[model samples]
Target: MATRAELTEIFGAEGVISLPRSEATAAGLSEDDARVLCDVGFPAELPVIFSLDVPGDPSAFSLVPVDTGADITKVLCLGGPSGNSEMRYCLDMEDGYVILLTLGRQPAAEIINSTVDAFVEFLYRYGLRLKHIASADDRQADEYTKQLRQYLAERDPQAFAEEDTWWNMIFDRLLGKEF
Candidate 1:
C-alpha cells in the first residue's frame, strides 16, 4: 500500500484531504482502509470508476451483506453508488482488495484491484477519462491516454498490462456497451 506521503506526492496536496480519525472510525473502516481514506482522499468525480460520496456519511460506510439471501458478511462499503447508478465500489476488508458491487446485477461483487493503493493508483493514472472522454473531447482524451500509458509503463510495467485489460472490460460494462 502506498503511504499518504507517496500518494500526495503523486497526486499533489490539492487533490488529497485527510479526514479526522474519528470520522474514519465512525465510518466502520478497517485500520488499513481507514488509513488510506483518511490520509488520501479520492477525487470528486471518477468516471468509469466511481464518484465518491461525501465523507462522514454514516450510511455510506459499513459491511455489506451478501446478495445471495443467505446471511454472510464479506465486503465493506467504501462509499455510496456513483451518480444514480446502483454500482458501488467497496473493499474486501479481509484481503484489502478493491471490489465493485452492482446491487441489481447477478454477480453482486466483482474484484477490481488487489488493494486500495492499487485502486488509487489506477485512478491517478486513468482518471483523465472523467474530464476528457466524459466531455467527448477526443483530442484531449487521446493526449491523456498517451500520457497514462507512458506513465504506467515507466512506473509499473506489470500494472500497465493488467490495468489496460481490466479497465477495458470494466468500462464496457459500466457504459452498457456491447463489444
Candidate 2:
C-alpha cells in the first residue's frame, strides 16, 4: 500500500485538477450531466481538465484502461471536437473502463460525476479500495485526503465507523507516504 503522498507523486499534479463543466459541454455534452454507460461505477469526479493537443481533426471517444495492480479498479473518459483539443474529463483507475456516450450536447458535469459515483459504489460493493490520488504539495494532499475521508464517511457511514483497521489501511494505501 502506498501513502497519499506517494500516490500524488505517481499521479502527478495533473491528476488532482477539478473536472471542468465547460470542457464537458464542449465535447458535445451538456452542463451538469452525469451517468455511467460502461464497465462499473467510479469515485466522485473532481474537476480536472487534461490537455491532449495534437494535429489534424481527431474527434472520437477514447477509453483508457490502466492496470495499477491494486484491489480497486480505474478508468478515464476523454473526448473533444478536434484532435488538438484536450479531454473534458478523465477518470483514472485500475478496475474498469469508462463508457463512451455518443450523444448530442450531454451534461459533462452530471455525466462525469454520476459515472464516478457509480464506480465508487461498485468498489464498495466488492469490498475493494477505490483508486487513490493526491496533490504534490503537503497542504494540498492533506486537504484532498480530508475531502476523501469526508466522502467515504458520507457514502458509507457504517463501514467507516466500524473500522479502525480500515482507516489505517485506507490511509496507508491512499495517503500513507506523506504521514
For TM-score, the strongest prediction is 1
Residue-by-residue lDDT tens digits, candidate 1, 112-154: 6667767766675555445456665656666666665566455
Off by over 4 Å in 2: 1-135, 172-179
Per-residue lDDT value at 60 in model 1: 43
Candidate 1, position 65, lDDT? 67
lDDT string, candidate 2, 75-103, tens digits: 34543313324233344432222232223
TM-scores, one per candidate: 0.61, 0.27
Give the distance in Å from residue 96's predicted Cα in candidate 1 to where it truly belongs: 0.7
- What residue pairs clash in candidate 1, if any at all? none
Please list the C-alpha lDDT of all candidates, in the order they appear.
0.59, 0.36
TM-score of 1: 0.61
